[model samples]
Target: MPKTNWKRNLYILMVCQFFVMAAMTMIIPFLPLYLQELGVTDPQSVSRWAGIIFGANFLTAFLFSPLWGKLADRHGRKLMLLRSGFGMAIVITLTGFATGPWSLLFLRLLNGSISGFIPAAITLISMTTPKERTGYALGMLQAGAVAGGICGPLFGGVLADLIGFRMVFYVTGLTILITAVAVLFFVKEDQQKKEEIVKTNTIEDFKKIVSTSPILSLFIVFFIVQCALIGINPLLSLYVQDLTTSQNVAFFAGLAMSVMGFANMSASPFLGKLSDKRGTQFVLLISLLFAAIITLPQAFVETYWQLLIFRFLLGLCLGGLLPSINSLIRHLAPEGMESRTFGYSNSFMYLGTMLGPIAGGWLTSVAGIRSLFIASSILLLINVLIVKYNVVPAMSKRNTSTSSKKKSVANL
Candidate 1:
């Protein structure tokens, strides 16, 4: 095989990730409002529909992501990216033309079913990059997505205010379409022949991968971390409302939400580089520990500003997590099965994403909103132990034995 231009690929994919994330988020700020415009006048109904529409995509994405991963392995990662990117563009554009809540909900479901561009991109980058550079490259890729997510809501709000909600969807669709074109033109993949590729049963393949302790631990950690991160989201605004004296509760809540994103965006690249220099497990463990610690304080904040500050700190800790986890997965994955592994990992992630809000809402109803933070903290603490005992010790033992063999070879 000829040498791959991984640097070029990474840069291009970063841009694609940014736009894709931006497109996804651009609809968020206006989703409920758009539903209202489409004839859902009852406030309670609007709220119910908003939750349903929002979650519809993730639910389907959770079910379908592994299938996409299997296909990516069989054909190519680039093809999957193109499929998702174009698929999203068309669905989002169709969403702009939706006349009722059902149509919009259906479109969101379709969108979720097709979702995998970012995961595919990650798999491609993981496959192409040199092992030593994986953490930094994945971190950079994560930063692009984070940056887009940070900017998207703000831009969506401004655009919604200026041009109205429907127009925002049109603009978002166009932006995604542009990203797909960029990928089509700029990104390249190393194609493998059918005869060279080994076929495997998807169910059996998933079982084989997760049976490994370190990788299984990482998958569980992915679920727990996502649950911890997003579990607080549904109630965050309500929590802010309780903590604040200001009349503009919406603005303050939005600010609180955005500050975390800003912090994550700023810290991701630096932490990624740090993981590269130090080690993925080192970064993952420290970040998980600190994230758990920071999360505990948010449950007790008396003022909105205090909660905001803690959320920011939590984001800083979170910056190290996904990139390090991804780097570690790449390190641990068997050759030629990288995409399938990532696909399964993403399924766990989407499952967490779907479950997080439900768990948060349930916890709030049963135990109150503050308990959500505490529960998240406990989950993350469990993850810290998982990494410490299962991931770290296993990695160290493997490294030590590998080193001993190297020394033996040198002496011989």
Candidate 2:
């Protein structure tokens, strides 16, 4: 790789992430309505089927992400990117033609199986970019993703009104197809094949990840954070309704959801740079601590504005968490196993996405919506202690061991 080519690759990949993420989420706001169009007339059945369709992607992604990662390691990250990008582009475009809910459900599952472009992009950049620049690059990459997430719904909503939901899927498919083509034409990935390791597979990769304490800790942190954050999503609108008397409840709910994403996008690049300077462990600990502290206030908010403020601050802290985790993983990964490690991390993320809402929905029914926020805060705090006691000390020992080895090498 050229000295400056990594920068170009990062920029292209960031743009690609934004469009792909936007397209992936474009259907979300209108999904229930779309389901109704598919002949699901009963209210209860629509609700049940909507949950199933929404979760199907995450479920399949959780199972397949590691497989893609292992293949990425063996073949090349670019191949996996092309594979997922083109695969999803076609599958999602065809989603516009689903004759019924079951067919749409099948497409969603297929999309999840082919969903690894973002993770592949992460692995590619981690391999190509300088270590000093990794945090900033990954942070910017995260920004692209969040920015897409924030914009996608609004875009989808307006487009749905104008062109209809089916057309929106068509446009989304086009967007992905164009982005995938851009990646093929412009992105520079000089993926050198690693020396073959005998008896390598996704199962063995899982075992290796479990045995690696630091990597395992990062994965746990990601899972816990995702579960805590996403678990609130199902209840957010109801919580907003309890706090506000506005007629346009949907607007306020959308505000609550997008504000966190906006703050997250703004904070990610800055936090990434800070992690590069302050050390990732320190940034991770402080971010987790503040995130926990900030989360508690939401459970007690009396007004909608207060909730937004708390959510913004929480997003700032969350902006630090994932990039730092990725940075740590990039450094700790074995010589030829970067994609496999990141792939497993992606699995945990999807797992959280699938499980978080279930847990949150159950908790809300049993203990009320406010209790979910409190529980989220408690979960975050537990993560804080785990980071402080387990992850940070593990890093210290690794650093000490490396230094001692270097000293011995010098003495020789």
Candidate 3:
């Protein structure tokens, strides 16, 4: 918990977070294929079950994120991380051994129930880092996660094809176990013990956050932003197929996805530093505006390359979105309530993650693939206005009040 160890902890958490995201994402691309191997051989059933299998974790995760977060606040963030990391390592490994879809779904639910590694890491880093440097630290952490997400699908698909779908699960589990071990041995968590936190009603705590300036609004902003971003993913492969006559649509689809992650990872650290210097609100507002503008053109793209370019630009804008949202959450979190605040934010986020695809599918069935992009643009634009009215003025008012206190002390 010494000052110097914060830096060490941040670095270690970044690496562990990368492995955690990669390991989890590694199994995503093979769910439906794995279903066939498990005897759900009918194409229609596979598609239905694939969507169910993909969403099962998030549904459980949405329900449990807040509970784990509350525990993080009362116990220790490190304890939560170990509980999740080790628990997931076991659950995920067992997932590989599942003989049927029912077992797979049950194990995924278990995985989601125990998961809190990223949030725990975020809370720990936020508590440890200097306020002024928090944006930079969280940004770097996000970059590591984005990098893992980008690599995970590619490696998972290849490994599934080469070794088998089952073995990939074991690899994912082993990687997560190693990540847990790294955190156990190296990461340092500085937090109040259980007795130190005032025993307050969880509902009262939630009400307090809602009444506070910008915290609740920021939570909504993050959920909407995440929704707008993820809404495109379910349709992306189909969009790529429509644009290309070549059979290498998969390659182009991968490129489109990878390039966006590349742009996001490349821009995150720089944007985080910029937000620290200028302001997170300012950076976030502009990012939302540009993200909306960039998304609009995706609907009009005539070729894969044009869509690729827009997606990359959209990624650059999004790079500024998530980390800044997270940094602001850390700044605005009340004393002894930081982890709980993040917990609620994570709940809203998991909700968005679950709903985004469903919304996209529904919209696409009604209108078209092109309409989903436009709708995503509209959501971002709506968030831009929310931040403008709901988030921005509150932050300005707080800053003015802080400056007034400083001036009064100077006069004294």
lDDT of each: 0.88, 0.90, 0.88
Candidate 2 C-alpha error for residue 111, in Å: 0.8
How many angstroms is residue 245 displaced in model 3 relative to the true structure, after the best TM-score fit? 1.0
For residues 1-412, what per-residue lDDT tens digits would candidate 3 score against the true structure? 5889888988898888889998988988888889999999999999888888778888888888878877877787888889989999999999989999999989888888888788888888888899898889988898988899999998899999999999999999999999999988998776544565566776887897767789988999988977887877967999999999989877788889989999999999999999999998899999999999999999999998899899999989988998889899998988777888998989899889889998888889899899989999999999999999988899889879989999999999
Q: How many backbone clashes does candidate 1 have?
A: 0
What's the residue-level lDDT of 117 in candidate 1?
A: 85
Which residue runs does candidate 1 get wrong by more than 4 Å?
1-4, 193-198, 408-412
What is the full ranking by lDDT, best candidate first?
2, 1, 3
lDDT of 2 by residue, 79-196 (tens): 8989989998899999999999999999999999998888888889888889888899899999999999999998999999999989999999999999999999999887565686
State each model's C-alpha RMSD to the native.
1.7, 1.3, 1.3
lDDT by residue for model 1 (1-412), tens: 2345888999999988988898789888888899999999999999999999988999999989888988887888889989998898898888999999999999999999998889889999988888888888998899889888878888998999999999898998899899999999888887776656666777888887877658999999999998988978878889988998889887888888778888887888889889888888999999999999999988898988789889899889888999999998888886767788998999999999999998898889999999998999999999999999999998888778889999999999
Q: Which predicted model would earn the best lDDT?
A: 2
TM-score of each: 0.96, 0.97, 0.97
